[model samples]
Target chain A: MAEAAGYDPLGAAGTWRHQRAKLVVYTLLCLFALYYVLPLGVVILNSFRDLPDINRNGLIGLPHSFSLNYWSLAWDKFCVGGTCAGIEPFFFNSVSMVVPATIISTAVGAVNGYVLAKWRFTGSEVLFGLMTLGVFMPGQMVLLPWARVLGWLGLTNTTSGLVLIHCVQGLSFTTLFCRNYYVNIPDDLIKAARIDGAGFWRIFRKIVLPLSPPILIVTVIWQFTNIWNEFLFAVIFSSGTHQPITAALIALSAGGTSVHQYNVESAAVLIAALPPLLVYVFGGRYFLRGLTQGALK
Target chain B: MAVEPVTLTSVKAAPNHGRMLRERLATILPQLVLAPSLFATLIYVFVFCGWTIWISLSNSSLLPDYSISGFHHYVELWSNRRWTIAYTNLFLFTSLYVIGATAIGLLLAILIDQRVRAEALWRTIYLYPLAVSFVVTGTVWRWLLSPSTGVERVVHQLGWASFKFDWLVQREMAIYTVVITGIWQASGFVMALFLAGLRSIDPDLVKAAQIDGASMPRIYRRIILPAIGPIFISVLVVLLQFAIKTFDLVIALTGGGPGIATTVPAIYVYDLMFQRGQMAEGAAAAIMILLALSLVLVPYTIWKNWRERREAARG
Candidate 1:
């Protein structure tokens, strides 16, 4: 078996055979990439086109002219729900919901994770396991009861209500992330601090918190993206002025029974998507690492 | 100093007591930190699930009732036409979405592994969809696939007047539009996982195969794919969980329309519980979803535990 084949099967780079293969690979990749990119491109392009142009040029055709009318309308004038105010107010609501939820959830997860990873007590693993199981639970499973709970607390239809639900739900994932990351930290540092008469909080503040920026980045990015894009809870719990970008996006796009305004809908979609899009672009590897580890691990 | 000798034992005992108290506090601190999350999870996951079970069993309507009852709602749920359509769609969508995402993801990963230029650009292009909310994906895809205004209209305008891609409006073909959007959204995630798996494999394996007259496809089939089998299972588990809980996408994309053609269990659960105010039947539908998730997740948990034990034993 070792002596049968003498030549290199892969061949040198840029050889004719390899070139043909390269062409095929690039072509296929470009085609699929276009599949993903074209819709987005169309959204951006169509966002600039006025309603008349969309009707004349078709949704995918090159714009004969461009205008900023749709973006402004989507942001400032387009009616969402009963409010004639545009997505701007809902954008603020989402920020109000997402910021607190992300910070609070990540903080809770970090503390829980630090304890679960470093300060292991009896049945700690079982506790951790149960928490992780919450991550897999479908939102529908908890929706009705959670809503009742929120309503009982008089927090329903408030940004704070959305924050509370997201924080509660996000804990499992944040805990999982922080705990897994902390597992790789050497135990000796903790023991050394313990020998020096440090307690749990002191050691965590001094030793663990400093070592946490990486996991915190992962957790925050994950939570922010999730809470921002969340629809079901936001739609059900919040109404009127408190709806987030996602829920508002739905109301805006599906607002009219009249002819669907492709331009305004495209603009609204892009506006709602902008924050997460920016995060994905800038957060880069942290986004991928967070999602992959969050899913697979 | 000499007079202090009698008090030395008491003094030492005092410090010892303080130390013991401090140690006990340290021991309790972790549990205290962990208590909120534990309590939340217990209430949210288990208690809510239990609540749904109770509600499903009761003859509750619009509001929860305390009296215990039989599986009347479950029976009704099973008999309902909408519920049946939703149940069938779950299986159809899950299978197609999972299979399509996995296949495309693996294909993209293999192509990108061939030392392609601009790898980062390609990866970003693919993975960007994962960041978009399902709401957005649904809306965007709805626009793209709509018959009168989307691709069909555009293609027709491009001078192929006979083109007919109106799956969004057709009752029978409506669900497949969801399948397409689901794949478009998830294939990038699948590809990322497969690419990670591919990158982790030793180059020597490929080299060895090449030296032995093995073609690229043969090498992938025999060696590369088998080695990454766990990733495939992981991807399937993830995608199935996604499929089972898919509501936002369907809601935004089709609104479960063309008259109940694209209803999944999640949408079904939401409609009965929230929209129709049929609390008992909705809880029944939700439990069905929980069971569907369990069908994938229970074995997954067992497999994970088994693998951990095996690894521990090896160590």
Candidate 2:
């Protein structure tokens, strides 16, 4: 195959035909990339540019003025809904809600995955199938019940309530991810551990836990981004100070202000997006791994 | 060696009893660890679904009333103008969004699969939108699509005064705006999936096809795409589900506005239950969304299972 004329296995031989194909390919890819990056770039630039500059440049042009004030204002001074305390509180609300929810859901899911993959009690497969049904469940179906549940628990309109809701809702996905990953671990290793007098927790601690960091990271990133970005629940269950950044961004954008504060709102939107964006940039490999596993399975 | 047999047996039995107890604990531990999640899923999935279903059947309003009202809300929901429009819009949005995203995604994936330079950078750019919340995506897009400050204004300022991209505010065109933003947000995800599918195709097949003088497009169409047929279905099902549950995007993008022109079933549900205090009707609408999702998902799941079973049996 390598000896054949004009048959480049590595695809690096720059025949005229190959060069033109590469040109077309790069052109299309760059065009699509521009479409994807345009909004983000506009937002990023507008976030730092003055409102007057944005007004003059119509949001798609080079910045005439730049300042860090909008970031600060969006952080602590600008009003969202009725509060002048800015998006700071709501950002913290997302943080607090996401952190515990991610940890609890991931921990519980890790154990559930371990049991479902390794323990294999009778009917466990059925149980897992039923649990995974939660993944496909629309949030609308559970809104009324969740509202009532939260009310009964006296946790309505609180971040704790949102955390509880997320942890429960997130379990199915986390469990599915971890279980799928854990199923690939050879059974002989577990059997060997069992023969060595290792029990359930011991085997998990010594065998499974060490091999879990990859899936664990994937699950954490998945759950973190998801819970942070969750809107329907945040909007429905919480209000005002307790709302996450997603909900607050809505209020801020639609705050019925006569004039849109493009700069500050832009900064606020970026603030809301920063966490997941950072996660995606850093753990992109695991993020995509999670997405594929979470979607296809 | 001279020890009594009774003492030896007693010691052995004691250790055996302890070992049995330990074994019992080990057997139960997994169940114990697993029970909470199972219970939670049972409540969250089955019970919550049942609860909503019940509410949809009841005449609940202002607050939940347990009294069975016998599908009155479902009837009312079907008759409602907003609900009808919402669902009709959902169908349109779902079809367009799914097709558009999948087509664009397949193209991008194929393009990237040419072993493009800076593949990671390009993939990151395309897929980054999935990282941001829909609220953020919608907000940025809403800005860009707004006539006053968005593309229209920029084009108008740039020596072209007749440019009109006011779909965001137009009553009839608002839904298309949602579809566009959705495709923008989701196509990357589909692309990622397709790229994976493309990469997973056996190299020899392509090599053989090339040796047979098959062109690239022909090779992709006849060989690579057919190989990734399962991925196409997966992407379709996933995108359909996304379109069905689309609330945040619509809320942030158009707020189901231009006078309910863009009202999706999700926005309708939220409006009915939270804003209008029509809880029963809202629950009914919510069920409709679920039904729509299952309509796409059930067939997919069955086919997947059947395919797996056939493969297993063959193997």
Candidate 3:
């Protein structure tokens, strides 16, 4: 009836209006994209511009000359003593910490999810409840006591300390995901296995593990992203020698470095973003599938 | 019930051993699978959290001995003006950020759900910030808001001299700068959550509303919003948890400086232990945070479990 009044919901005027609205939304989203991507853009664009270019050109300008000087500067010269200690070492440090942390937590969480889902127990729910609690505790509360414990155990300021901290922090959410997803599995399969004289570990290893491909992927991606970019615990547990790139980048933020270091900063920033961005783009479908399965509850 | 009984072969398995061993393995395997998580949880809670609580009661420093000093630390934390200021700022910070982030994120989610084009592109736009670590973002935003050599400078040069984009320098506004930076980084996560929630609404409800001659806004208000209530609760809990732990941005942007104007509880604890050499005071503040977190989290856990259990029983 509305269309009959020559409103032309599908005609030129209607089409024009719809197209204009779409263009407007698209423009706004593009602007939002800029807002979201600026830190990265700034870092990447500036990475190529050298010291004088950074100084003369200001932050928003197209560089008159591009150089790898600042990446070299960050790598070789940014240290207090001017040793040209490039970001390469920190890159290796981060990879080492994040990989072990991600694997341990995700593996543990997968096992946890399988058990909680497939088995009945007197106190399983209580254990699950505690896992959730550990997930939310602020990092600050744990740092001091953690320092003492680390000092006592002689792991204080080591890669293992950072890994332990990240793993502990990552556990609660991973467990939550595993538990929620495992709950969605059927009971009959477990019963059938039990009837066949399979034990709990065997059934979990064979049945529940195979059935958990989607969630396990999600858990790995989430933990991997989280630990890769984790800053606070990295800062607290690491010092000059064993620092992750995040801790290294943090120096630029604390200032007294250079006001015109925007390009250098942008380049360094881009480097930090590379790991997770690659994960999302390459494995985006798996990423979203993981997100939906883990977070939808 | 039929399977719950042991059969003649089960009797032989139980008595003769081979099958009984298999049965025991079946039952115990789940527990074994549970061991690593249980071990991690115990260490996390008992070792980490327990030590945190112990330190909170004492006069321990950077190198704490764990020896008790009664409630002196807690008393100092309560009376100290700086600590009080930090707590007040954090309270206001968390409250405003959580509420604003959720409201804006949900609005964006709704707007995006209106059959817009290039949805994946839009989502990436919003979510790309999450990929930027706090280290880079806090500095970039700080530079953007800088009084002299930043975006503000460019705008001023374009003949907007009256414009003072210096919230970061002003003591009163410094905390707000951190808040803005935080929301910019985090609102994307909330948007993603709301987007997922929005996607799950039954199409039939929307069609039903449309057939009744209800307007789009009315449909959303009455039908759409309610369907997403449970998700709203999830976003709320996650947001609240996030708000409680905000630290990185403030540290990066202001370092809790300009006279500690932007100081928050987490920063305060970090300052005491790492920077100020006030280990006991830091410990006390950590306790206060735990107490505050529990004040919300414990009740929340209980309420959620009760609701879930009630729903299960009803089902």
Candidate 4:
């Protein structure tokens, strides 16, 4: 992992002092890693443990008894806020909301990026600046207006309404990602395509679209994870069967009386977290790229 | 010459009227393509912000009323005890969270940059928390921090019967649990950002410092950290925003609780707007949150732009 560029030559081969320093470094790294992974490991372990075992052993211990029963129970049988339909419907609500929001926002953002980057019109820079302001606008600032707007549009308390919110809310981020990327694609390419009598759509389809996959992946992962995990909007805009997994997870964990169902709740939490976690594991490079670019820019 | 003839032939082959229409369409195509997003963004940014600002200044309650009012809601929001607690909590959370996360992140980044083995594996472990939602992070931490079922119980079972890790239930200390969880979820992100910044620093500077017999710590303090100063600012800004928008994390973790001890501006906004039907004050609280964000963001943006312009001019 040591590249010549940034590698410290001071920590050269075969010195006890250097070796001791290395040991300290590794130890610290491992300790921090344990702190980072402990919660996830505990959750996974408790999800399969029997409730009695969890109760006896406490949440932080290794399981004494294991069963797959709670996974299915959390999926289909456990009641959340008096509804025994489990997390299945809310999971579907998230999926249905996330997929379209991701796709639509990415598609629109690509075109917006292409136009802003390649087809500079008068005042387009100012327009781009104004649009990017949406990136920093707090979600709280928009809730009242959105409530009124959704009411006006007859979209209150529906998954479709959440989908609309995500799309519009995600536009600035998606546009920023794609536009920064598209800026790197030489203008000469677009000009050449144009001189060949390729119209705007044709150039976009043939030239720009081919270069879009990297940014598109980043944008999609970003949008998917963000929209899926969004709680404030999900909690406020939809409820009951219409609620997304995040809000439902809150209700599920907060709802029951008597002894807390640690097993099922752990399983449900993992289920809610699974999609984005899978995306991160598979697309980590793009995910980090999106994060860095999104933050630094 | 070859390209010129091809273009001329294409122009000649197309019917004049059809070609003009196509030309017209092509001229407008980019704008047409951009129209919807532009319209949506304009509404999302300008219109929504304006509407909220207006509502905050109005007498709206239970529902929005369009009649103009003064800063009555803002006055009410400032004078309220819960709002005061929430705002103070926000200030405390932002400072501690930002400092704690950035310091830990920078430390981790420096450690990893020492050419560690299995760097990718370590990075993945550290950063995976960021992939999960704040809700998930908060919920999991809540379980782990709760005294009855979590760390305290586990420690007690290990034979320390007098152990007490019950910050989740203690009103004055409940906010610190949120801080701890916030640091856990976000510090790794700061590490990733700092790691990238560290990797981009010129190697020759480090080599020269080493040749001058400067120790590693001295080299880092005097040379490497200064080189990545811009990243520190970026990290600060991002973490500040995260701190300000800390809704779901606190909601899932403590529910702003141990009796309103952890109530943040976002939670307060939600309560007023939705639960209590105080829309105008809610809007005002929301605007306060917005104001706090803009106060941080606006100057940073202008400074960033000015710095970029200066760099370009220098180049």
Maximum-lDDT candidate: 4
Residue ranges of candidate 4 with Cα displaced over 4 Å: A1-5, A9-14, B1-19
Which sections of candidate 2 miss by over 4 Å? A1-14, B1-23
TM-score of each: 0.95, 0.95, 0.87, 0.97
* Candidate 1 lDDT by residue in tens digits, B213-250: 77777888999899999998899998988888899999
In order of DockQ, best first, we have: 4, 2, 1, 3
Q: Score the docking of each candidate (DockQ).
A: 0.49, 0.57, 0.40, 0.71
**Could you tell me how far off, in angstroms, the CA of residue B117 lies in candidate 3 after the best superposition?**
1.0
Off by over 4 Å in 1: A1-14, B1-24
For candidate 1 chain B, the 10 contiguous residues with the lowest summed lDDT are: B1-10
Enumerate the chain B TM-scores of all models: 0.93, 0.93, 0.86, 0.95
Ranking by TM-score: 4, 2, 1, 3
Candidate 2: RMSD to truth: 3.7
DockQ of 3: 0.40
User: Candidate 3 has what TM-score?
Assistant: 0.87
RMSD values, in order shown: 4.3, 3.7, 5.0, 1.8
Q: Write the per-residue lDDT of candidate 4 for residues A1-297, one digit (tens) a residue.
A: 335255574474348888888988999999999999999999999999998889888999988998999999999999988789889999999999999999999999999999999998999999999899988888999999998889999999998899999999999999999988999999899999987778888998999999989999999988988898899999999987899999999998865456789999999999999999999999999988888877666
lDDT of 4: 0.90
lDDT by residue for model 4 (B1-315), tens = 444444566557857898889779889888888999999999999899999989888888997887889898888898999998998998898899999999999999998888887899999999999999999999999999999989999899999999898999998899999999999999999998898888888888888778777888888899999999988999999999899999999999998897899999999999999999999899999888888988989999998999999999999
* Candidate number with the higher lDDT (1 or 4): 4
Q: Kindly list the interface RMSD, in angstroms, of each predicted candidate in the order they appear.
A: 5.3, 4.3, 6.2, 1.8
Candidate 1 lDDT score relative to the true structure: 0.88
Q: In order, what are the TM-scores of chain A for the candidates?
A: 0.94, 0.94, 0.85, 0.96
